[model samples]
Target chain A: MQQKLTVSQLTKYIKQLFSYDNLLSNVCVTGEISNFKLHSSGHMYFTLKDEHSVIKCVMFKTYNRRLRFKPEDGLKVIIRGYVSIYEAGGSYQLYPEYMEPDGLGDLYLAFEQLKQKLEREGLFSAEYKKRIPFLPARIGVITSPTGAVIRDIMNVLFRRFPNVVLKIFPVMVQGEGAGKQISRALDMINKARAADVIILARGGGSLEELWPFNEEILARSIFKSEIPVISAVGHETDFSISDFVADLRAPTPSAAAELVVPEKDALKRHIMDARIRLKRALAGKIQREKQFLAQLSKSPSLRHPLDKINQLRIDLEQLNKRIENAMERKLESAASRFSVAFGKMDALNPLNVLSRGYSIARSSGKKIIKSVSDVKKDDMIEITITDGSLMCSVTDVMPGT
Target chain B: MDEVKSFEDAVNQLEKIVELLEKGDIPLEESLELFQKGVALSNYCARKLDETEKKIIKLIEENGELKEENFGQEAQ
Candidate 1:
């Protein structure tokens, strides 16, 4: 100012001062947020203020993605970042790297944040869950090598289904590197194709002890497993992130074993019942067939097959007798008609006149001489009787008056 | 009673035979054959159940090769 420095030069000098100050370079601020605005470029601009003062804040998308809760106006929060001056505006603002709700612990907030994120992504949707195998040939277990959880599971599984194969993958259930170990075991199981189904299990413990199960890495691994996963973590009341991501959830490790396989005695009873039903069904089928055969045998056509032929023979004989009687009547009527015609012909016969001693006289040329005028004196004549003919010459000529 | 057949297969076949017989429309000779096969399958399943014993084995990686060891009371 004493040298009459330009406005841009003064702003540059002040920006360098804020950037170079170690205390101002990194800070933790606790205040109520106000006038929060998230730009289209994914950069957030807000004002963090207390009763006495306020400071401008900006969080890029890179840092905003790391925040667990939604940042809004009037919400009290803690921000850890550094102060930087914007040379163009000549204003210093907090560039936040991390942010959290004021009253919540980091772990709790992280859990909620991850849960909400995965829920929104549909990872925990019912449609994503695979159906657990009814009869798994091999069951893969991921848990502590030496623990009541494993022992209880083994005992229950062996008791229920003795023939089922169980493969245990020893893993650290809690503490440092536990999440990575659990995740690796799942990957190994899937890669090896060692089991038909996987059981992710742990005994009852406090929230801190059960932190590995809540890890995002383990949850994603369980969600992406090719084989169905049954999560059995802690007591009935204890719920973990694995439980929500798994295909099936059992209250305890022993309960998981029980749910995985059917009881041998129950299966045996079922088979026996099936056998009984099979026998009954077969017997009923045979009985039905036998009745059908009996009914067929009792049918009239089959019982007396020749009866129809006998009736047909009787009908043929009656027809033959009627035909013979009709032919006899026709011959009798024909013979009587012939006799009637013969009697009538006999009455017209000229032989009957000859039988009564009558004769017909004819001239020599076969002409009949009915009177003496037809005959000349001394002419020859023929007289015909019924059986004979006579030739005679007339001795006297007489004319009939 | 094929040795290679699984108990589950045997039980499934037995159930199918029962269903076939229950329909009551098959020839008598075929029904008899199915009944005989069903009886055999039932016997095989029962024997399998009675004869099976619990076996627990542990898988270990030795020299990058998976090996099986008998897991018994000693581990417990």
Candidate 2:
């Protein structure tokens, strides 16, 4: 008969057997997680299961700290670790050294999870985005020092805008500690206020290679940057968390360079166009003013000022002729009336009778014998004529029948 | 003109000059003055665009102070 053993002894023997087996010592198992619990002591206990089977798993604080994503209940995952028997519980379980999400990979799941977390925190809100400068005087680039990513960006930037000042802040694009290195560069650039805009650029790579950009620290750093950030990571298809948090996102490194500054040739063309428009506008204004002046010069009052003066002169001559005619008529009528009055006075005068040769005789004693009745004898007589005065005495009057 | 502050300001002034001239209500002497100013502004803007050279620099920390290093034609 075989010797019997205590429960603890049997369990320890099984644990020893498990430690010696290479397959059980280091193995990868796929299952769904359930009954997950994280103790305050930083130990994680969960059960991973599939449609057909389940396994109890434990990831300690040390290994749990390295997990990129949180494992939840019902989550299918692939764990890499050793299978060992718990001597006290008398059961076997999986002690996972590494855990990853099944099918989708841990990095992608972490990216999605962080993206969701930041989205809820409003880090990707449109209101938080800063406006990119239309003409940035200085552009800061955060990328690898030696690679086509930097070369491509430099070529594009220099070819497009020659006047821009480019400041390169070299950092590791992908690898261990790349995320922290990138975050530090961002902080340095922001602290110095060295550039108007920043370009966080990297060449295309696998999801694993581009993991640094998906870090939460880097996302927050890019969001908190004072300068506007342009995220250009991987190819067009790859969308990292930095791309969502940045002010703008470019498809490629070359594209980011193109977005930072305007093309010199395009600006030159714009200036030329503006110059031509200015000249045309000025020329049109001058032509309009010239036309206005020409219109004023053609006014009737300005053209025929002498015609009005000549008409006034003709009216003055007509007034002078009317006054002269009236004066001459009045003078002739007054002279005729004065001559009539003089003739009437002259007819009443006795001088005309004297010139007609009528005379009167008187006696020598100056008495006139009129009737031949009683007459004194001696009387002196005088005679008067129109041309000479005649004295007659006692002239006899003859009574006309 | 030396009082002009920037290329954009110069361009803005030129546009204003053109607008004032376009109104055609100003005196002849004033219009001529504005035209002369606009011409000068245009010349200044063109010269600013033409005279610039490509510049590349690196940011470095030295003795706990941020400094710049001129990257010459080698970068090109």
Candidate 3:
């Protein structure tokens, strides 16, 4: 007979046993998940199973917080942890610390890992790859001959830039032998070397549908392509190895064409703008030169090289002649005054006056009486003539003295 | 088409022309030369746009060989 113990005591004993279980702490278990239920409380409960075995597993809220992908039923996962008993239920289970999809179940992880590896290798470097020609004589497309990817690309390229020469290199984009077809298309086109750039595209699909682009062979081919490759394999969220290896990765097939060719409308506008700028700049330069010439031509030195000096000389000569004439006139006037005074003195001399036949008389203390009445009173008088002095008598006098 | 060069070569040449013009130090004679080059580049770009204007109809395989089909309009 066994001794019965209280439920709490039994639970405590089981909890202590689980804490000491070293083998349960860290373990790697791979099996299909079943009975999967995620509680609203943010905890995950499930069972791990294979052909004839199953084990209860619990991913608690804390550990589940680290999961990058949502867990679902029928998914095979590789869990890390050991089997431990819950004290409250006395049930034994695998308490997972971490989990990953079995056999690389997450396609996104594979895509990311490949992307990172390729990036580190510099396969997608802009330096190593050539840019798409601004004006391509021809653009070659490699995709499924009948898919929206090609149509979208074509429509956009046509709408944005019309009259583009597109050569389609039809190939299978999915399923068996897709990698081969794509590789063959690339090889053939490069050999022909007709197109300026190559665009490889496909519509968005499930992971299986996009598997062809993930093939290592296809990625390698894109890297080695002689013509620049633009990979537009799927939607924005979907990425493949081809995307990283190609010269450029576009979010969609339409976007790839946009990258490959220049838009007609935008290009036209750009050309117009460039033309305007060129003309403006040239005209501005020419205008500036003309203005400079005009300024130089306006200078007085250039306009009248000799006239200014000649005019000054003429003015100087005129001033000099005027000064000389004024001085001579002043001297002549002074000489005229002196001559007049001399002439007067000469006239006053008796000898000069006699030549003119004129005479002058003056009454003295002995008066000369010219009239008969004056003769009676006449006394000694002096008289003067132009030639000589003589005793004189009074001459006949008019009435009314 | 005769002006067509490698994409990288053309882009590099275009960049050089832009730089020379931007410096504004070129003589009038040299500036005219550079302007001519810039015109050629713009023309090349126009030609590229013209080339893409042609239509490309994507096709899908209904049986064995691929056939042209419209997108979002059909179920495969």
Candidate 4:
């Protein structure tokens, strides 16, 4: 009798078997893709099918993040991953770690490989890119001399910038030695120090013809140039390695020429505009100053200087009157007080009492006699009246009765 | 600016002066100086744009040495 096993138990056993098998643990499979699904989680799920059978495959977000081309249904690709059993789903699937387009040409493959390698090396980083000059004094162009590319560039450059200086380095833009010649041209341009900026340009061509721009040597040269390089290789849609590494990328040679120099008339107009503004600003400033001076002149204080003086004078007179009034009031109160004191002192004055018919009698020795007992008969005596003292002899002494 | 060396510098300075004066807060002495400087810059820029003719020169590699020649009229 066969031993009974649960579904999970069977799947786990098969998963262990697949894990243990070396051949299943490492695999590289090539087949047409089917049922490709890119989940929102960035995981890629697909099926690989041959004419006879199909195998389920899944590429996790980690593996698929490095893929240059998006994997699609019915596309042929080679995937490298281990065939593993998912115990939860009770199925075995191919877990692809790497994937590449199967039948794409070698040129594209090489391009992709180089781009990925250089990107990993950080050569195409935006931080490494130099800024194109706002306006270049001299523009150095590297391209085939005989082609319309040169003429178009010259036309644009001369038409836009009437006083522009252009330095063109003629080079072969195609075939075997083109990349080396362009590289040498870049070095020569840099060494000469003649150009404010350089433009490496070519017309639209087949990928074979335009391959020189995509060459690593030219790319590295453009990246290494101290002077900013503007790349205009092939058509607008065609992107090359030099385009990525150059300081700026233009769609065409004409566009590069147009970009390198500012239009002479526009610059003239800008200067003229600023000049006019300067004039107007100075004039306006002067006008404002004049208006401000006029306003100041019209101000009450400045307009009639004597009005302020007169107002101050009036205020001074009012203050003087107030002080005089206060002083007079104080003096009058003091005089009244003096008059009252004088009256009281006059009442206490002995001269006033004596002038009122009272007399002070004294002996000749100047002693006062208050009663008859103070003097004897036949004694000389003196009497003090209002105005004078009189000496008399007392005939008889009289008592108070 | 200490000196106006190139058309770009001169124009930049002129524009700055214009902006400064346009604010109307600068003293008269400085405004007069800026106006004089701006006039000089404008004249220099105009002369620079007018006096120089358009020149297109070509670099010919002769015996591994590069030399310059006028290239616009003759595309060689």
Candidate 5:
């Protein structure tokens, strides 16, 4: 016959055994998470399960605090922790020290997850990009105080622009606290309202050296900054989360400075060109008005004042010539008509009748002797012919019916 | 026309004046006014460009507050 152990005593023995086993103490478990829940006490209670078997797991608050992504049901994850038995409940459970997504390395997975998360939140959308100030009086630069970045930036900026202030906010470019330092610098620069535009820059390095720029905290800080940010992190090939979040991205810090300011000589030439254009435009306006005045002078009415009067005078002279010609025509017709009537009158003339060899007799009183008794008494008579007159004495008077 | 607030505004306004003049239909009086303002704005922008002294500064924390100083003079 076997003696039975109490439940607590048996569980305590199993917990001790789990702790002593090296493989059980430190193990790596990969599976899909299910029944995941975070307790109010900050412990994550979940079950890691494969196709046939499931393991109960609890990640205490301390370890979960380090997670870059929140664990959820149905998420495939690889966890590293100790497998220990809970003495009170008499069950074996995995106490995870670290948990990460299954497919990618820890940092890269964190970047991808944060990128997806922020992208879902619309941080990388085009509309969110701020317009960099034109001719910013103070340009804020965030980089290491001692590096080729700051010096190269200064050199490019000085070469391109002559009339602006460059304000550099130095921060550690890499390592554990670098993200925090950069985030803090952004806040401080924003708080003081020191700069109109900020350029966050660094040189090229391995993925780990550029890790700080990929941090979600730095990305969020850059997105939150009211001032426009230009991110110039690493070489052209290196892209960081800050590059996506910043308003502008430059291939290099030197390139950032070049883009940030207008070229001084080019600007001078621009101003000069505008001035020349102003002068030319004014001259053109004056010239156009002058031409207008000239055109006005050339208008028909004002051009030649005497032309209308001259035209009227010529018309009046032509009209007078026509009137004289009409009168001459009327006179010629009247004379011709008078001549014809005169010819008819000539035909009816009494003298012309006498010219036809006709004769007449007359007494002294010029009475004609037409019968024998017309001249019986003392009367003077005359005879008339076509060309002459004859006188005769008559002793009697003649009367006839 | 408003006050020339910055080099950008000044240049932008100058460009606008140039465009107006280019149309060549504006009255003489208005053209003259635009020309004068344009010239003045051009001069203002030039003077602004001239006034900037190739300045570089850095921020340092002296207690809890951030303040500015000349950029580290190592390379001048």
Candidate 6:
């Protein structure tokens, strides 16, 4: 018998052997990269090597796509992965899900790494950035009270615009707990609604000194702020995570303050200019009205209506005088014609013929009969003349010879 | 940068005045009132700036008691 064993017993022994063999699994390693290659199929293969030891690593397509920066050989990296046996090769390797650049100052490396990460994520995009208010009423400042940063900001703000109200939420700007403290200050300011604009500032300092501003928590706080924030940490050259997440970035604390408040002098000058414009416009309007009044006064209807009425009155008077003269002449001519008719009638009157001695005598008056016929019979005569009436009795008869 | 209790109120009032004046339809009596209020707000803002002179005041926190440290010189 050759040590006959059951199948279960053999498998158990193999499993136990693999379990106790701590040569692989759950390791944190730091090393420089070597033999790094990116496959067209979207897989990453690299070797992590130290002075004496080396390990093979693989980052699948999904994980490789999330990397902030490209990985190259000779660049130091810190990796965390679980060691697993490759089923095909029957070898142990690292399947790293995350890696970070090494050898950079802890803060600087963290800053660059986070900045790159966020830039890829589009957190610092201009489309998401809010425009600063032209004239913020209240400004909140988070900084160390005793530092020159606050003093510089105050000086510049007062000099430029004397009206902006500044609320100081004093906090430790450096040291171990600065990040959490800053986050708390930001929360308090937001809850209080103490300001419309925020200035997160600190004076220039070394990488370690400015580390707290690069904190992820602070960065998130700045990103979530309802009020517009301006990060003015350190000098112009120094960049921090807070600068990326903030709505605006200023070179210095004083510059941040300048950004928040509009200059009073410039505003006053604008107002003065507007005032002048308004006055000029009003004057022009008044002048236009005056011209309008002048034109109205000169209108022919108003100026000459009375003259037309007077002229019409004179014409009426002339017509009345002509009518009166024509009426008088007509009456005189009518009277003269009546008088002439009266004279003509008088000329044809029998009394006028009688006055002209044209009457005839009758017998006498029959005594003057033609043959004097017979006076035998007593004759009575009646005679009529135009001037007077005479009565006579005719007692004789006329006889003709 | 001066620390004021009611900055928003002052600024809002100032803005209202500006708008009213710009509308150009204000009654003559109301214009005078608005002008007076504007002047008051302007003076208040100026005084706030003046109040923040350079006073080197120290914050003393001894035994958790916060006290002001006043510098000898008065800043003008």
The numbered model that scores best in DockQ is 5
lDDT of 1 by residue, A263-352 (tens): 888989989998999889988988898899999999998899998999899999999999999999999999899899988888778688
Clashing pairs for predicted structure model 4, backbone only: none
Ranking by TM-score: 5, 4, 1, 2, 6, 3
Each prediction's whole-model lDDT (CA): 0.85, 0.83, 0.74, 0.86, 0.88, 0.72
DockQ of 2: 0.41
Worst 10 residues of 6 chain A by lDDT: A366-375
Q: Which stretches of candidate 3 lie over 4 Å from their true place?
A: A1-127, A307-401, B1-76
Error of 1 at B54 (Å): 3.3
Q: How many steric clashes between backbone atoms does each model show?
A: 0, 18, 22, 0, 17, 10
TM-score of 4: 0.73
Model 6 clash pairs are A363-A366, A364-A367, A365-A381, A378-A395, A379-A395, A379-A396, A380-A393, A380-A394, A380-A395, A381-A394
Per-residue alpha-carbon lDDT of candidate 5 for residues A1-401, written as tens digits (9 for 90 to 100): 78899988788888888899999999999999999999999999999999999999999999999887778898899999999988767789999999998986667767777888889999999999998887877899989988698889888888788668988888899998899889889988998899999999999998789989998889989999999999999999988899999999999899999888888899899889989988998899999899999999999878888999999999999999899999999999999999999999988886787799877888677887676666666566788989999887766554546
| Model 4 agreement with the true structure over A1-401: per-residue lDDT tens digits | 89999998888888888989998888989999999999999999989999999999989999997764667788888888999887778778999998888889535765777787778888789999987876677889999888789889888888888777788898999988899999999988887787889999999998778888877888888888999999998889998888888989999888888888889889989988988898899999999999999999999989899998999999999999999999999999999999999999998887787899888889877888877899999999988888998888999987876
Please give fnat for model 6. Answer: 0.00
What are the candidates' interface root-mean-square deviations? 2.9, 3.0, 5.2, 2.2, 1.6, 6.9
| Candidate 1 stretches greater than 4 Å from native | A1-109, A125-127, A329-401, B1-17, B23-53, B60-67, B72-76
lDDT by residue (A325-394, candidate 3, tens digit) is 8988998998999899989988778667766875544456445335544433444456666557887554
Q: Name the best candidate (by TM-score).
A: 5
Task: Count steric clashes of candidate 2.
Answer: 18
DockQ winner, 1 or 3: 1
* Ranked by lDDT, top first: 5, 4, 1, 2, 3, 6
Per-residue CA lDDT of model 2 for A97-206, tens digit only, reads 99999998888899888999999999999999998876678899988867788889998998887777888887889998999888878888898999999999999999
Instruction: State the displacement of the C-alpha of residue A104, model 4, in Å, after optimal TM-score superposition.
Output: 1.7
- lDDT, model 3: 0.74
